[model samples]
Target: MEGFQQQFIISVFIILLGYFFKRTKILKESDGQTIARIVFNITLPALVLVTFNQMEITLPLVSLIVIAILFGLVAAAAGFFVFRSADTDLKGMAIMMMPGVNVGLFAFPLVEAIWGREGIQYFGMFDVGNAVIVFGLCFFIASYFANGSSKFYLRETVSPLLRSIPFLTYMFVVALNIFDFHLPTFLLDTAEIISGANMPLSLLLLGLYLNFSFEKSWFPLIGKYLAVKYGTGLVLGLSLFWLFSDYPMLANTVLIGFILPTSTTAVVYAIRYRYNAKIAGTIVNITIILSFLLIWVLASFVAYH
Candidate 1:
């Protein structure tokens, strides 16, 4: 309990530190976008490529995927339950939770650090599941709310994935690992050093970036995001852990990844599709703020052994 509490406190502090620093007079608002791009395009990609690609596929890998997909479905159901009394209902809930997850370093590496290689192993396996359902369904839901037909342009929809150089690099790395295409130790060691550097640098940059936007943004939207997106996903995550405590570590990883705060990139999608960027950004921010509490309760339960 003590360790869990400590970890939770640190997580909350880091998030608040970012929020508060951004509110102070350190940088201009434009710097936030600059920092975000650097994280996404550079450091994050390096981390993903090294970690994700180095892992090999196996039955356990498949199990992780199954777990992620099932978790996604379960979360969707919970979101529906949350909004049952609302006029918009499940659609709103789905848009809030499913599509809003930050799948890259925002989630995967954090799980890795929390649980170790086993922690991130599930990330390599389940990230695909997270990608397809969370982002995919979010797009679908957005289309569902549109005035015309409900179907989306599949090509444009997956264009991001297609152009994801890091993801592509990861695929090759995994293929090599699975095929036993053993590389020199120096190469592996190099990957280890570089991949490991990603998180600290990116987090620092995030800190630097957050130093720019301290002013109040959108509290109401943040509140709604907390209630539906994070609130529903987190509750479902905790419930799943309580039930599957036998596989505590795996359960913990998947649930946290799902229950994690909305990715800021979701705001880009919201703006691109005209789905409500203000709402999505607030959801992302509040989710980041609240997830530490939910994750702590869950890790305390699941990692208790």
Candidate 2:
């Protein structure tokens, strides 16, 4: 308990530190992209290699990947039905933003701080399925609504997954592990050095990009997002917890996985699709704050050994 509390505090403090840097203009908003590149292309990939290289692929872990994909689809469907009456312009943004978890950049730092390598490995596997929603379905939805007549192309949507450094690293490392191939000591040592920076760099990047603005127009949309996202998460997460009380790790994964904030890709889609950027940005910022609090409460339960 004490360890969990300490790590949580450190996590919050680091996030605040990044916010301070951005608010004080020590770093510009555009600089966030540079930091993200470092985290994703370098530190994160290294972390993936270091962790997945040793973990064996198991049936449960494979199930987690499938659950993540199914959960994403369900969440998106729920959002669409819940807000079916919303204006056509706003409906697309709402549905696109509702489903996916920010499993990588947002959840990884906290998971690593609490449960170390195994936790990361679990979430990394879960993210493979979620990636489809983030890079594919959500993108397609946004584009569809943005241009009224856009068609879904598997190649176009899946391109982001193919280009993702961390995703490729995950696949490479997992393949090597399954084949019982050994990574060279020198390579693993180098990766450990780089991967050590992953958490702080990711948290710092999150802080840099955090933005919130109050708008009367956005409140209802934000409210609906909270109710749909967290509300659905709470019911499903708790049910999973009770169902698999003996398997604390898997149960907790289900809980935290659903509680994770909306994918940042939602905002990207909003902007690219020419949807209501203000509402999109507002929901993203607000949900992030709420998710931090919710995850903290959850960490108290799941972070224990």
Candidate number with greatest lDDT:
2
Per-residue C-alpha lDDT of model 1 across residues 222-300, encoded as one tens digit per residue: 4544576666666666676567667666567657876776656556656766665555554555555466566666666
In candidate 1 the C-alpha lDDT for residue 100 amounts to: 41
Among all windows of 10 consecutive residues in model 1, the one with the lowest summed lDDT is 206-215
| Structure candidate 2, residue pairs in collision | none
Candidate 2 segments exceeding 4 Å error = 303-305
Q: What stretches of model 1 exceed 4 Å from their correct place?
A: 1-21, 49-56, 73-100, 205-225
In angstroms, the error of model 2 at 55 is 1.1
